[model samples]
Target: MHTIFEPMKPIPFSPPRIDEKTIEAVTEVLRSGWITTGPKTRELEKKIQQYIGGGPVLCLNAWTNAVELMLRWMEVGPGDEVIIPAYTYAATANIIIHIGAKPVMIDCEPNGFLMDLNKAEAAINENTKVIMPVDFSGLPVDYAAVMEMAKRHAGIYKPRGENQSKLNRIMVISDAAHSFGALYDNTPVGREVDVAAFSFHAVKNFTTAEGGALVFNLPAPFDNEAIWKDINRKALHGQTKDALSKTQAGQWQYDIVEAGYKCNMTDLQAALGWVEMDRYAQDHLPRRKSIVARYNQAFQSCSWAILPKMQDDIVESSYHLYALRIQGFNEDDRNALITHLAEMGISTNVHFQPLPRLSFYKNMGFQESDFPRAFEQFSNEISLPIYFDLTDEQVDCITSAIKDYMQSR
Candidate 1:
C-alpha cells in the first residue's frame, strides 16, 4: 500500500481558493430565488466601487464582454484602430477584432512583459482610437507615461483629415484581467485608467466563477450613470429591464432599446464575489503574497531563473501568476524543461504565446520579428504553481524539479 512515488498528487498551476463563506453565500443566493442580475450583483458592484475608489463598476459575464462592450460604447468600428500589447491573452486583442476594429499590436518593454510605452506611442496614428494596455501577470504597465503620451499626442494628429481640438485623446482602456487588486503609484489599477476590465474567472485571485467587472473613469460629458444603464441594457439582450426588474409586480413590461449582447453577471456568481471581495485584502492577498515571496526566495539564487518583478515604488502586483523565464533557453529548451517538470510530477504552464505567433493573427499579417521582446519572453517563460493551498513542501519540490531539470540538461 506504499504510495510514496505516486506522482505527488499533481500540483495545479492555479486553483480557486474557495472556502465555507463562499459556500454559504452561494447557498443563500440559491435560496433567494432571484438570481439573474439582482441585489447581490448590485452589492458586488458597490463593493468593487469602494474597493477600487469611486468609479462606475459594471459587472458582466467575462472580461471579454466588458472589453467588447466598452469598445462598442466608444463607437469603435471598422477602419478604427486599437493599439494593444503583443504579449497578452487573446481576450485583450480579440475584442478589437470582434468589433470590426483593427488591432495594432505593440511590443513589450525589454526584460519586462508590460506594454512598451514608446512603441505604443509610435503605433498611434490618425485612425487609432484606443490604447489598450494589458497589466500582464498582474504587473501594472506604466500608466503615467501612457497618459503623458496620450496628452502629448492630443493636438497634432488628425483623423479622417478632420480638424479636432485634441488629436491625441486616445481612450485608455486597460486590460486589467490580472490586476484587480494591483496598484500603480498607490492608486488601484481600475481607478487610474480611463476604463479597466477585471476578470473574475475561476482561476483568478478573486473568483466569481465566470464573471468580470468594468471600471469606468472617463471624465465629464460621459455620464457614468447613462453609461451604466447602456451597458446593463447591452448585457441583457438590449432589454429595458432584467429578470429581477421584471419580478416586481406590475413592472413586467419592458422593451428592447438597442441590439446588445447577453453578458450580464448572475447573482449566483456575484454571491461568490461578495465573499471573495470581503476577504480579498485581509485574507487572500496576504497568503498569495507569502507564497510569491517563498517562490522568489527559493529561485533567486538560480542563475538561469529570471524571476518576474513583483513590486517597485510605482507598481504593486496582484501576484496573479509567477512567470519564470529560463535564461539562455530557446523555445525547445523551455518546452523540454516543462516536460521534464511534468515527468517529475510538478505542474507548470506558460502565461501565453505571443499573439503574432498564433495562426489567426499571423495570417492577419503579424510577424514574430515585429515584437522581439514579447517573442523572447514567450519562448522561454514558464508559470509555476501559485495558490493559497500550495504548501511550502510543494513549493520546494517545484523549485527543485526546475533546478534539477536545468542542471541535468
Candidate 2:
C-alpha cells in the first residue's frame, strides 16, 4: 500500500469538463423561462446537423431513447433480429429486446473491440433486420465493408417463404455513443452509416449534460421531412405540436398521433450543447487527442501494455476513451491493479464486461465462452482517465503510477 504525507487527492476517472461558460449558458436558459423543447433545442439540432455535414438531426433525452425510436421508426419488431457486438454496453442489445426483437450478438475482432465483419456475416440470417455496429471507444468501424455485407446479404436473407427475388435491405444503425466527432475516410461519422445515435452524456467528448441526437441519412424517395416530423411527435408525448408550436397564436389545439415515448431534449440541455458543439473541434477534440498521444507514448515503453489502436486507413477516432490491455493479466489481476491505482490516488475504470458475463444476459442463454475475443479483451482492459482538462503533469503521474504498480506486482 502506498502511504502519503499529504492527503491523497482523488483523481476521478472521467468527469464533466464544465467551466464558467457552460454554467452561464445553463443559467441563461433558466432565466429565459421557456426551458422545455424550444428555440435553443432547435438551434442546437441545426448546429449539430451543420457540424456533421447535413442530415436530419433529432435531439433526445438519451442515446438509448434515440436508438429505440430509430428501431420503432424503421418498423423492427417481433420475428426480427438485430446484429450487434457482444462486447458493447447492454443498452445496445437491450433496445433490441425492448422492441421484441432477437439480439444476435457477434464476436469482436481479435485484440480489438470493434466488430469483426466476417463474424457479423456468419451471424446474418433470414430474420436479420438490422446490423447495428458500434464505434467502440470513438473508433469508427469499417463502414464500407459493412455496407458491402449488407448489400450482399440483401436478397438471399429474406423472410422464409417470402419472395427471394425482392431485395430485403438490412438497415445499418450505428451506435455512435463515443463517436460524435469521429471520421470515416475524411467524412463525419453520422454521415457514414444509414443512421447514427450520438450520446451527449456528461462523460462523453461533446456533452449536453444529459442529452443525445439521431442523424438520419436515408436514401432517395424516403421523405426526410416526414420522418423528422414523426420522430418529433413521437419524442414529445405523441402530440401533433410541441409546446413551442402550441404557444403560437391560433395553434393551441392538436391531436395525439400515436402512443409515443416522452424523450425530448430540453432547452437548458441544448443551451450547453450549442456552446460545447461550437468549441468541440477547436478546444475539446485536440486536447483529448493530445492526452491519448501522451498515454500511448508512456505505455509504449512497457512490454506488458497492449494499447488500444487509434489509427487506420479508413477511420479517425474522437479519442473518447484510452482502453489499455495488460498482457498476461486475468480479471483478478486487473482488479488488483485498479485497487492498487486507487490506493495510489489514481482512479481507473473498466469499459465493460462482455454482455454474456452479466447475470441477466446469462439467464437469457448467453455464455462467456461464446465470445472468446470479447471476453478476453474485457477481462484485461482498463480505461484510464483522458479528458479535456486532465493536465500533462497529471498524465505523467498516472503513467508513473502504472509503471510503479507493474514493477511492484
Candidate 3:
C-alpha cells in the first residue's frame, strides 16, 4: 500500500544550523571570565551597526522588548494609538498594550500579507503616534509610500513630549522580525524605517538562540549615540554603570538613572550572532534562496499554486518563510491538507491567524470581519520547510507531496 516515494525521514519546519565554527565561538564566550552583558554584546551592537551601514543598534533579549524600548524612548503611553497589521504575530501589538497605548488593528493588503497603506492612511488621526509595519514573509513593505503617508498627515500629528515635538512626525516602528537582510529600494530595513526591530530567534533565518535588536534610522537633530546610551541605560535597570564597568577598580559605585526594564543581551547570545552574521550574507541567505527558488520552479505552472515573492529589483527578501497560498482552498480544506501532509511526514505551518480573530482581541470588541483580507491570507496559506540544511531532493519531495495532495482533492 505504501508508495515508492514515501518519506524516509521527518521534516521539521525550521531549525538553526549551528556548525562547529559557531560552537567554538560560543565556547570561547563560555571560557571568557565575563559571561554577562559585556564586551561581546557591545561588539555585536557595533557589528550590527556596521552591517546596517551605521545606525544606532541595541542588542536585546527579545524582539518584543526591542520595540517597547523604542516606544518608551518615544514616550508612547495612554491615549496614543499605534497602528499594527492584524496579520502579524501578537508581540507586535502586545508591546503597544505594555506601554498603555491602544493598538489599532488594520487589515492587510487586499491580496498580500503586508499592511495596506491605503487603509493605514485612513486609520491615522490626531492620537496616532506610531505605525508599526511588519515585513511579513520576509518581504519589506513600501517604505517610501509609508513615509509619504506619514508626511501627508504630519499636520494632524500631536507631539506630547520633547522627543515627540523634536521629531514632529508619526514614527514608523517597522516590525522587521522576519526580515533581517531584506532590502527595499537599495535601503536596508533598519535604514528605511524610523526604528526597526529584528528577531534572532531559533526559527528565524539567523539565530542567536534567544536574542533581538533595535536599529535607528532617524534624521538630523537626533543624536544616535546619545539615544544608544539612553536605550542601554533603559535596558539594564537604569543603572549608570554596567557589570563590566563595575569590575573596574574605581568604577564600582553607580546610580539608577530611572526605573528601566531588564532585557539586555548577554555574551553567549552575541557570540552566536557574530558567527551567524558572518555566515548570513555569504552562505545562509543564498542557500535559503536556492531552496525557495526550487520550490517556485516546481509550483509555478500549477493553477492553484500561488507563489510567494522571492525578489524584485526594488525588494529583496531574506528568504525567511516560504508562504505558499493555494487557490480555492478554504480553511477547513487547508487544515485537512495540513493533516494529510503530516501523515506523509512533511511538516507544514500557517503563517498567522489574524490578530482580531483571536479570543483576546475578540473580547476587546475587535472582530474578524474587520480584517477580511487577513483571514483570507490565513485560510489557504501554508508555510513550507525553509531552513539552510533542507536538500534539493527534499524540496522535490515537498513539491511532489503537495501536487499529489492537490490531485487527491
Q: Is candidate 1 or candidate 3 better by lDDT?
A: 3
TM-score between candidate 2 and the true structure: 0.96
Winning model by TM-score: 3
Candidates by TM-score, descending order: 3, 2, 1
Model 3: ten consecutive residues of lowest lDDT: 1-10
lDDT of 1: 0.85
lDDT tens digits, residues 17-68, model 1? 8878889999998998877789999999999999889578999999999889
Error of 1 at 147 (Å): 1.6
- Model 2: per-residue Cα lDDT over 1-409, one tens digit each: 3222344467788888788998999999999889999999999999989989857899999999988988887778889899999988999999998999999999999779999889999988788888999899999998878888888887656543221122257878888999999878776689867788899998899888888999888766566667788888898879988999899999999999899889999999998897898899888889998999999998997899999988688889999999999999999999999998898788999988888988989999999888999988998999999888898878888887888788887
**Which digits, one per residue and each the tens of the lDDT, describe model 3 over residues 1-409?**
1134854698888989888989999899898877789989898888888878848798999998888988999999999999999998999988888999999988989778899989999999999999988999899988788888877888999999999998899988888899998877765567877788899988998788988998877878998788889998999999999989999988889999899989999999999999988888888888998998999999998999999876787999989999999999999999998998898888989989898878888888999888889998899999999999999988888888899778776
Q: Each candidate: what lDDT?
A: 0.85, 0.87, 0.88
Q: How close is candidate 1 to the true structure, as a TM-score?
A: 0.95
Model 2 lDDT, full chain set:
0.87
After superposition, candidate 3 runs with Cα above 4 Å error: 1-3
Of 1 and 2, the candidate ranking higher by TM-score? 2
Residue ranges of candidate 2 with Cα displaced over 4 Å: 1-8, 157-167
Error of 1 at 258 (Å): 0.8
